[model samples]
Target: MPISDDIKLGHAERLLAQLRESYLQDLPNHCGEIENLVLSFDRKDPETVFDEIFRHVHSIKGSAGTHGLHLISGICHHFEDHLKTLDGRFEKIDGRFINVCLAYIDCIRTAVSLFEKGGETLPLENELEQLRKRFLKNNLAGLLVSSSNYITMLCQQTMGDLPVKLTTVDDGFAALERLLQQKYDFIITDKELKQLNGVALTLAVRASDSVNRDTNIIMLTSKMSIDFPAGLAPDEILPKNTGLSHALVDAVGKIFNGK
Candidate 1:
């Protein structure tokens, strides 16, 4: 005999309930550990604590989504993104970000508690969106490096209304120097950059001790080839075809939304 659809559905329901219950029970302990990290953040080594917090929040984010708790998952996603910003600068971790993380954890805990008690998650869509906008406005900065002022202007126009501030540099070597002297959340480069090409610039960024060593990079090129070396990887690649501005803008929107 084979299991019927109804039976399968019943089994899934039971499994979901069990998992949700387990998560609810463990939520406090998880939140407690995060709070401890927040309180003792000044004393502990930053990289270790950041990695640890990221793991715990990431685990919750994954499991929350698995159990149909999207509110928790969404919150964790943004929190995880913020945590990544502290990656190379763990030693100089920002206190404001730490407070924000704690506040997000609190929000998740409260939401989980409400859902468990009433079997319904309260609506927080508006609140969450406001919080997201606030963080986006304050937390993100990026760079656009291209020899073409036309491309730079298009990018600037596209990003003008968005949350991040985009800085433009005319040459690749200058961009590399900026990477060393400052920090940015992302960089967009043209393949034919002056002073140094895009590929060499990426290689330099990866090898340098700049705070943005792992900064997100996007490359624009008129041609694509498989023979390009493996280490010169950019986060995204856009073809410099007609209407490249729209394509670039769309990709940037998606990237920002994901964060």
Candidate 2:
């Protein structure tokens, strides 16, 4: 049976929302960890560096899948495969290899930014495919859930009465795009997302046609020193360690009442 376009869009929105929430809630630390690993790779031992890179890419691939960034996850899968092939080989880690790795990181960064921007069609599909075929020949395709999944699950459990949609994504721009198409009373985000980050996402939402016209936004962050990004201000920023539920409810109420 042909699926209704409405249903498809609705499902896509819900999924995207979940992804946005997931990445916003996590990803920062993950990206940081990968960056650290890359920097820590042994310059004298290409094999050791390959191993380190493999682990970092594997972790990213796993997290990307869990958060529903299938494209990002797929790209990481390919990168990981490339590292695996060089496991036992004593090849020099040339500038070209570094460039490819940097490109992958750039892609991941772009993907993260896109999610906060409300999601956009990615342009790295061909590169991702080529890298995947070249690197992950023996790898099996599968999904991996991330910690953000648990956060969203908690949100759903707690806000059962509110008609809220949650999504996970590799790009905040894409999430913003999805959010603009719908009428959401409130938007909740975390500080640690990949590309756009929480502050960026909030600003993007506020600047968006629907959100800028009028949409309540609440930012959740583990950091205590989060500041509003330039040209973007959120309605509120709540500490993740504090009373998250209370802050969210209060923010929503204030926005709804024009306070």
Candidate 3:
């Protein structure tokens, strides 16, 4: 009989775990190189260091998806796209661009900590999001996919400072419709949603024919043992814990900037 998909995933995850160690080991070295590139960037051809950084993230993007680290790959995908848009014109690699580059490296560094130990070292989630928002040309339009009034309030209060146009849905099916209907810079969801659960809604959004398929997603959940469903990855997950307000705000802020 053919192996069950679950079994295959189990095997794949084990392999990824082993592979992760190697990645974690090499991570600091890669980060150090990026730092050095930034420090020495002024005297160098901007394109040279830019190409190196692009290729660095490009490599990670490939390896991560292959190992089922789709969350990491997804973040890198957006990061890589940002760099690709600035492929040439070596003159734009200073100031804000430098911060974006350094921040991307830091995100990669934080990624390893997540799977290795439940994200204890990922203190810069807010910082990460803020940088993304600052650099992106338009960081508006956000969707709050939750049935809980509390979730909306938390997210709204957290993101009140941002200029994002917010839309809310208490129904997962409606959330999916909204996602397909228009583009959103960010999506914040809860796991215990009605009509459709958040993870399944996310999966549907990911697999659907929506133009906003690549929008940054945050699974704001209170549950512990829930694994991300197969072939589906949310860009980030914020626990509905004591820090929910801060975390949601930071994550939402990263994807859009009305500033």
Candidate 4:
């Protein structure tokens, strides 16, 4: 590499390191605020206090992601998911729930400490994710199969606000396995896929007597249309175009309404 280019790269790296150091310095203050909010449930209005707690955690997660602290970001992400499971029911906000929230706060503190020490943080991130899944166990389950991050983000933006717990996979065969082994309220897949395409997977589900045989399925395709074999068609086949987000919203709405 050119000497000038190498110098520029080193300068950028140094700037980034300084920025990360600054964020780490302030992280404890963020964690402490969340801990206080969680413990203030009895003294303050529960809804307002919980909202403040969520906002602090969310800010930390975003900042951590921007600084490339993915483990901290992921732990905070799972913590946010656990908070969502409450659905804003102040009545359900009890001592045990406060303890759980504090535990998440403590997890964030531990992750920050380990990060400073250059220790592994994956195990902590995974444990928090598992705890989140357990809390969401009773929520509506939905599976999405697509290799496109664009599609995944779009789906999350449109459908994520709902009370549904989404599981994502990029392969058709893997999606089929999940369908057979577990029940899902809905399935979304790209028409073109590896191992088995969406058409084949949809056919398998409809042909089976499994619990998800009658579940709603939404198929996304780049093409305008597809000719499905008779007696086997997904609940909705949407074209992946400018109107995809709207179509997805409408399709999901119809599914909820049993259309």
Give each model a TM-score. Answer: 0.55, 0.39, 0.49, 0.57
Tens-digit lDDT string for candidate 3 (1-259): 9999999999998887788778767767877886787777788877777778778777877777666665566567557545754648666666777777677777777777786777653355455456556665564767788888877887777777776656677899867755664456878888889889988888888888665687888888767566766657898887889988877667766664422
Best by lDDT: 4
Residue ranges of candidate 2 with Cα displaced over 4 Å: 1-20, 42-48, 126-259
Indicate whether candidate 3 or candidate 4 has the larger lDDT.
Answer: 4
Write model 1 residue lDDT over 1-259, tens digit each, in one string.
Answer: 9999999999999988998899878888898898888777789877777778888998987787777776777677667656765647766576778777877788788777777777454355455555555566764577889899888887888787777766678898767866764556788888898999988888889778766688888888888662345665887788888878787777777777776
Candidate 3 global CA lDDT score: 0.72
Per-residue lDDT of candidate 2, residues 1-259 (tens digit): 9999999999999998787677655766666666665655544455565666677777776666666676667557445544544447555555555666666776677667766676664466555555543333433221111136655555545455543323334456555544543333456666666566666666666676652335555666677776665657666767766477766556655654552
Q: Which portions of model 4 miss their true places by more than 4 Å?
A: 1-3, 137-259
Worst 10 residues of 1 by lDDT: 119-128
lDDT of 4: 0.80
**Rank list by TM-score:** 4, 1, 3, 2
lDDT per model, in order?
A: 0.76, 0.57, 0.72, 0.80
RMSD of each: 13.5, 19.4, 13.5, 10.8
- Cα deviation in Å at residue 242, candidate 1? 8.6
Candidate 4 residue pairs that clash: none
Candidate 1, residue 149: how far the Cα is off, in Å: 23
Error of 4 at 153 (Å): 17
Clashing pairs in 3: 129-254, 139-256
lDDT of 1 at 181: 42
